[model samples]
Target: MTDIPRNPLIDQDVWTGRLFGGAEGSWYTAGETRDVTEPATGERLTNIGLARAADVARAAKAAAAAQPAWAALPPRDRAAIMRRAAAALERNLEHTAHYVARETGGIPAKAQLEVAEAATQLHIAAGLPLQPQGLVLPSTVGRTSYARRVPHGVVGVISPFNFPLILSMRSVAPALALGNAVVLKPDPQTPVSGGFLIARAFEEAGLPPGVLQVVPGDADAGAAVVEAPEVRMIAFTGSTAAGRKVGELAGRLLKKVSLELGGKNTLIVLDDADLDLAASNAAFGAFFHQGQICMATGRIVAHRKIAAELTRRLVEKATTLPIGDPASGTVAIGPLINARQLQNVDSIVRASVQAGAVLEAGGTYERLFYKPTVLSNVRPGMRAFDEEIFGPVAVVTPFDSDDEAVELANRTEYGLSCAVIGTSLNRATAIGDRLKCGLLHINGQTVADECVNPFGGRGDSGNGGSMGGPADAEEYTQWQWVTVKGAAERTPF
Candidate 1:
């Protein structure tokens, strides 16, 4: 295998100390450090800094101290910072794109798309303050009342490694626009690509010092932020097991929480559906980003009549995807994030074979590249069908009826996302509504997500973030009611 490129020392002049102490706008390296390896070739690309729980505490304290003044700023002024940050990101898109691709094992095209999406979210966030519509109730029984939206004190944003920039920015941009100071803790695996760049943007935007702090670390640091009493809300996106732990910590502290956890999502195709579109969507959803997405369509339920054809088409399309260096523009599939992920995916493939599942196509894990794998006759009881194989693996099953498909789709404890494809719009709609998932797409696999709509799970999949729609924004904030009574007509005790 070819050796990966070494970390360019372009930022050598940039300061390196504590990732948490950057409240003064001067960049600081994170406290603890770890080596980042190229997943495919197992070569060390660079050394990344990792923060500690102490760092998280310090960052939370900084955010708590700065939140009130930042919140007091006029809404439009806060939005102006978001717009400025978006502009800065646009200017540095190449740097952001390259690092994101290299650090996360995501293809260059996907990285560029994520960066663009994040910039768009920032633009949208920049517009929120101008559109804060509150209810003005008419005078009732000789009294007038109105509702007001206000920012929460401090918000803790914890994100995962996959799609680091877009997912992390989705929460941070909105929170900052809403006038809340933020403590952002990105996954250690892609710390610089995910967190440092965000910190730099905030500084370039001229945001008030301490309004945003980047602290990179592992689950321990994440737990610190979730358990911090000063944090008004914990916004988290990660695995179900880890999310549950964070949620419990937040609950114990009585803080509001947003949890975007794991998913074993399913894609359903009826006999009457357009086989071409269904096959393409399923193939991309299952193999794109090496199936690292939280909402990847891992389980495919095709109509019995069309199962054979759909599987054939899916295999044909999936195998054609190119797996290579993530920085290469031509690469469609990329390596798994790390060795552990590759091993985990391989174990599942082995277990599925042992359980009598038929491997339709590639099922080999060579280094970090797990061949674009397709499995057929995956029994419901098999590990491949029951658990989340977060690699380029798709398990296909056949359903004779819509009811049976829905039942199979909902069988797993997760209810994150599902896509239904059928020729009859009414039939697809009925099944889409019936499926137990947070986000449902009819006639398509899970497409790229937008911050405008609520994107999360329904069941054990986990609670969602509060920055999507108006209701979601309200969910993140607290309401203070006011009553103005006539001086002369005050209530007589």
Candidate 2:
């Protein structure tokens, strides 16, 4: 296995390989590279190759050319390759965590978790090739008929910087496993963990040439992926605004598109609930990974009877949590991904406070480490309530009844996930039924994902493109109906 070089010497060719068959992206030959800076310290981690629109088109064409042979391989052979790829990916997890921590400003634990989850996704993808691809159907003419799922030829993937590894792997692994070629365009902010590493793993596991093309790039490469005729489908994970643009372009080209967009999720607290447990769950949901997750609880709608107490608890927890360079020690929260992100988060906090929300705990920062924050009296029009903060800020509001709670939870234009806290499962389930998000957690936090459960959003959050077993089957393949018989069939004409 080609170990991801750990020397930190920033060798351009070593980190960003220029080979076409998954070892390197096509853009490196042009000698135009982008600086990947560490968010925590503003240190230049490495200079990664940048992909152009032409490079994306080239990669897509290569991936399309390689699909037939890859699909022709036996399913068992494909599955074995997938398993080996999973193993190869596992070998790099430990060192990869350090890189992720530095590049993305995530704590060691968060980085480790991302690596572990990425490996798990690969393991799940290993079985995708072996799963039954078709269903037997009865024919009107008494002929043996069936419907089979076939690969989409080439899939173009555009991933984000936050949770880079798992987000990119979930789509790449399944598409590759189901016999589809892929041209991956990871966010330029996270080329290493999101693009090159996964491609290298597959290549090391004996994947044939041209099956996977890694393109680490910015908007030009992303636009090229959607516009390239060879890419039959698009799997994009990013902000809602960007996702809408992707969907628009893919739609114009008549391409199959799966969009995993942003979220302004919520967690509802009941009057009869345990405030301590609810507060704990809310804190983790709102501040975990510094609330950069799509499923992070953006708003906490508590019962008016207990809103004050919950707000106090949240404030206490937020004020005490450690904020520093996560690579230096065990900090509860790390820096924002970059100065841009830090400014955006700060703006939201400042705007909300100006718009009448009370900042109970924090609303300041030193460098990129924005303190975990708590805000009370937040209303729908405030930036903290309406916008996706994508930071370590929890906005608490009060709802008088279950109906009001449901109304508050469902008010956001984005509907990705929601959580309900109540004394009994039946009570929570009753409240959960009214919330109109794609994923729900009764008496739990909103941040969760597994191989079995479908992951996606609703409304502005996404366009019904989810990731899971059933979703993988549908997203990675197209349907075809076939009929066979001993005798010649009659022609309708």
Q: Pick the candidate with the highest lDDT.
A: 2
Predicted structure 1: lDDT? 0.81
Model 1 misplaced stretches (Cα beyond 4 Å): 1-17, 20-25, 29-31, 138-144, 464-467, 485-493
**Per-candidate local distance difference test:** 0.81, 0.85
lDDT of 2 at 17: 36
List candidate 2 stretches off by more than 4 Å. 1-13, 17-28, 140-142, 487-493
Tens digits of per-residue lDDT for model 1 on 1-493?
2233323311422424346444563556665677666665567656656778887887888888888888889888988999988887787777667767887888888888888888888998888778854677666675668777777788999988988888788888888888788889998777766777787777778889888988878889998888777788888888999989988889888988888888899999999988988888899899889999988988999999999999999889777888787777778888998888889999999899989988888898667888999999887999999998889998899999989999999999998889999899999999998888888998889644876887778667887443475545675566766556665474678
Give the clash count for each candidate.
1, 1
